[model samples]
Target chain A: MTPDALEGALRRPFAEPANDRVLDAAREAFEDVGIQRTTMRDIARRAGLGRATVYRRYPDRDAVVAAVLMREVRVFLTWLDERIDHIEDPAEQIAECFVAVVTGLRGHSLLNRLLTLEPAAALPALTVDAGAVLAVARGYLAAKLREHQQAGRLRSFDPEPAAEVFVRLAHSMLLSPPGCIPADDDAWSRAFARTHLVPVVTG
Target chain B: MTPDALEGALRRPFAEPANDRVLDAAREAFEDVGIQRTTMRDIARRAGLGRATVYRRYPDRDAVVAAVLMREVRVFLTWLDERIDHIEDPAEQIAECFVAVVTGLRGHSLLNRLLTLEPAAALPALTVDAGAVLAVARGYLAAKLREHQQAGRLRSFDPEPAAEVFVRLAHSMLLSPPGCIPADDDAWSRAFARTHLVPVVTG
Candidate 1:
């Protein structure tokens, strides 16, 4: 898909405005205060909606947080899909995808704030829902890896596990970045991917 | 070092009995309640020591908790050192280390309880001190990778970044394990290291 197509998809209005507003407000509040401290009333106030409206849309704070995270993942995948679909080489595609994700997440304001200001509250949401979240990412990568394998562009391996490692590595770097690697630099990501990621995925 | 030598080193008693007792008590108290809820009084009572003695040993709850965690890390590293010292193959050594860590952490009662019961409290300790903790792990791995590179057992690559990736991957898996890969299984860990880790270190 073209970048314009991806942007168009992202720009499409949510079917439920109240839900979208609640999620946006929750994301902002989560970044500002934290998940544990943020209340439904605060979210409602931020969204410019009544408590009843917020309640009707999201049963509780967890629901709103989950919605926000799901939305973030969807947006990230859309952005990634647009740029990587045309890359023919499996290693290059995977490398580019990793670089894009690291750079994209590094620049993301809410995510960066959440990790920095409120890690305790943020970590639980990520850890407990890790399986579900990783399933989405693994599915995306596994499908791509399988395609490459079938086309003789990648080596034989169980794409699911390989993709799982890739996704886990990305999540780890994104959340608790070990500054040992230059994650903010795209050249570093590509070189690191060539030595570390490509062999894992293709071998 | 031989197994017996390692055991002998571990058998050496702590320099200060009061410090050891207080730290042990703090760990238990943290596990029983939580970091936020556990008080100096609770720790003193758990240690079977008077309030004055506990105060003299540790000024506050945070100090006691930090001491406990530092001691725990030291013990874990010592134990790991004993097990991995004899393995000559860099790949095998690294794989065994990862497997040992995953398996050891899975069975750690206090850590598991803390993570499961009071993630909001436990997560802060991990995240706030992530730099210090990763530095220790990264330093150890980088040293090993460099030694291997010098010995011609590993290929030419920047060892620091490679070590960072290795350590980060382990930390991520330890905290929020992805079920897509069976990290707890020894055979699986070995296979994974051979395919993924060996290449990263030796490429």
Candidate 2:
């Protein structure tokens, strides 16, 4: 499926209160026992909703998982927007965004837990099946780059591919950070971004 | 383990003729039944060697898998070296290297089969447990960048981290491959490397 379609489907469940309850319950269950063991009925029981109600909103557990993951991405994007909104320099903004994403994802509880406990389940979502997450993040960065271009702070370039490259750098780093690169160090991440990532936009 | 140590171990099996036979058999078995189902005994039988001989070389199936992957990396690196041997400009060389790697990997039968049939097994080796592979590739690029620096073709920077970034970009692109970025297109990949990757070295 196209990333936009997948992202739209993921966002649809956010509009309903019942869906919110379902996601909250799914998150709790996932944290308690893990995603592999969290059944549809278990989610319904935890949410205090009927099985049919949960099914009406989400066709199966995978859909619920995708929705939960998308919500987390939304939360992350909002936090990222707030952090970088004040920065006017395109280079520094991009650098700080990279730092924030790497640090934020490193501290993310559910993602770390899933990686540790159930890599089989978590790896695919982050790697092969990461379309929705990648789409949302690339969109966020592309929009920011466009704004920077409009403000005459950045040159005219296809922001989409540049944004994808930036996002992928962060994605690869978080998944399997190389030994040469320091992890979770704010100063190091910032410097690396300035040297490596800023050029992608400014050049 | 350190990447150097892992790489050293991965290369050790190459000195033995029996090890080559074992790896060939293991590759065949992996291509036939997939890595998850390929066993030491199966490999030994296919190689016309005793189980003790196989066990003596590799303590387990995981070790065999690592050795096979490392061998493939070595072969690819050799091919890459030959392909870019005559290029004078560092930017064009890096661009061509990226194109070669992305295209070479996309057509790799064993790696492709594993990624398609047993992502659970393949993903970790490329992502979380990718230290050896990443180390080998990064080391190769760092050496090349260092050569450029020595020859005054490129400015001095920590070639190590820069190389890691290059390798990780290719790594992530091969694994997830965002929709915004065109795939398996030589012109696009080369242009991307020039626009996005060359800056990491030249800037």
Candidate 3:
């Protein structure tokens, strides 16, 4: 489901202000603290709703964390699909995508908190089913690679493995931020697009 | 001093029957209850030594843990350096190193306990001092890669980044093992030598 669909499912009555506020609070509060530490009561307080109202909306902590993460992933995918085509080379596209993925990661308080703060609790929530996301990314890269092969713009190599390398490289970049990963991160996207990213496209 | 120097020093002074027994006890106790939870007094009791005797050898808890870890690294490296040449191909050697590394990791009760039982306590140990151990591993890999490159058997690339990738991949394999990694892992070394590694060595 899309982010909107996900948000829609949370609100049973469709116009329930309490449901929307609870979800917003859950997103913010979970991002601030963590899913393990964030309480339904805190969400309710932030949403200006009663404890009963939160209980009415959602059952427990995991659900809220899931909702927020799902929304973020959907948003990220949507953002990525828009900007991937600007770079001409398929390999470049893949590298830029890796750059893009990490670039996308830096500003996300929820993802940052999950990664940098509570890895034990955060790993499950953040990467519960990363295969689907990886598939989406791989599919995009594979198609682009195939296109380049057809155009004779690059040498013949297995697009699938190359795509996997990009995905894993992106993973490594996140796991241990390189010197170029950006302090303020204002230039991370561009720098990654230029260096680690450009090699993929050119290779 | 290097792990070799440390090993030689520890051996000359303490490889007699009594000291060996104490170290064995300390290793087992550390594995059973974690570094933080395992006490010197408890270790001394396990080793059949008085508190004063244990304290006489290693002044502090940290000292004992460092000694144990140092001992473990020395043995693993010495073991690896021997079989490292048998693989012949640069690709196979690197791949073998990964599988061997994992197998060696399986029997490491202390490292396993540190990671599984108390990650918050263990992360600092890995990161506190400019990541010296990681730098050492990176250095070793860089040297090996350069050696292979000089022999005209492997692809020439920036060894530093390649070593970084190897380290990151190996580390991830240790932390979050996926189904792609072999459980039995006997053929893992040769299999990696064939599929993932051979092509890159040529590049």
Candidate 4:
């Protein structure tokens, strides 16, 4: 279908499918010129949309960037869910999650580029901002922990705090992996999860 | 004592007492104008020495900055040792260390200023760059862990890697504390250490 027709069909009251197209274009522009230099016009042009339409969808470049980052995070979390959905044991599930997250982030082209080129902008969200993405991550993990606790698969603890620790640990390693843990070593990552992480939520 | 007399009394073969003066001067300059803008001449002027004397002590501004950073780390380590030296329990020691470090960094004038004014230059040491300061921190912790393990107080783990995790966790929290954990809550910080950290080094 044509871009116009596709957007018209995909646009919802709260969100639109065109949002994805605009963000994808924004991601490309950001990669090419770096986030600091990429403009709304560039994204609009790349998305095959008028500046007015792009502005209607996203008010500014910062809004577009936030959408792009959130979209990326959602996509990654979806992949993560699928990867560890079948694991029965919480320990195994967390271990797999750690290994998968580290491995996935290591290969993530856009995130790696941003970390290398635009760390000043990107690092704050992972580190200091504690914004929507982190809240979503913590909520997701907490729900899982709660579910397992109800099912008698896990011990009783404050799942929110436990999930918070898990999320921060994952973020810390991804942003600035410890020197002692050699990168790309899945066995070591899993072992670390088992040794250091598994005990946090378990009895 | 006069500067010249002090230098004669304190100078060694490889490093001289003047090095301390130069580094102290550079630290002040870095704190005032930031590492990026602070020049060797500024440091020399602050040290009450000639440009040639400062240059002889440190080859360049970067060298002076490195020495200043190392000196600061040494001072912090000395303080940390004194604070946690009397804690007998391994878990208690680790927990207190985390609280003390977070508290210390929060109050540190130079570090707080650098983090705010020159994050681009100062952040790498805590995150990406594995510098001498980080190495010294990890080594100090590892030595304590090793001693504890030998005394049968903690688990038998690779002290270096364990120390690396401890150091990185502290750095992560200092650099980007989790939103889940409230800042400046000594109780929460200690609980986090007891829950997540003490396990790694203790059985």
**Residue B47 local lDDT, model 2:** 99
- Write the residue-wise lDDT of candidate 2 on B1-203 in tens digits: 33454346445657678889999999899999998888788999999999999999899988888888888887787778889868878999999998888878777889877877888887776777778788888888887887788899999888888888888877778778656777679999898888878998786
C-alpha lDDT (0 to 100) for residue B115 of candidate 1: 74
Instruction: Give the docking tier of candidate 2.
Output: medium
Candidates 1 and 4: which is better by TM-score?
Answer: 1
Q: Residues B134-168, candidate 4: write the lDDT tens digits.
A: 66777778877777878888777777766776676
How high is each candidate's TM-score?
Answer: 0.84, 0.91, 0.64, 0.81
Task: Estimate the lDDT of model 1.
Answer: 0.74
Model 2: residue B36 alpha-carbon error in angstroms: 2.5
Native-to-model Cα distance after best TM-score fit, residue B154 in candidate 3, in Å: 3.8
> Higher lDDT: candidate 3 or 4?
4
Q: 3 or 4, which is superior by TM-score? A: 4
Q: Give the per-prediction TM-score of chain B.
A: 0.81, 0.91, 0.67, 0.85
lDDT per residue as tens, model 1, A90-121: 87998899899888878888777777777776
TM-score of chain A for the candidates in order shown: 0.84, 0.90, 0.59, 0.86
Worst lDDT window (10 residues) for model 4 chain A?
A5-14
List the candidate numbers ranked by lDDT, top first.
2, 1, 4, 3
**Residue-wise C-alpha lDDT for candidate 2, range A1-203, written one tens digit per residue:** 33454346445656678889999999999999999999999999999999999999899988888888888887787788789979998888888887888878788899878877877777877877788788788887887888888889888888888888877877787677556777768898898888877876665
Clashing pairs in 1: none
Model 3, global lDDT: 0.59
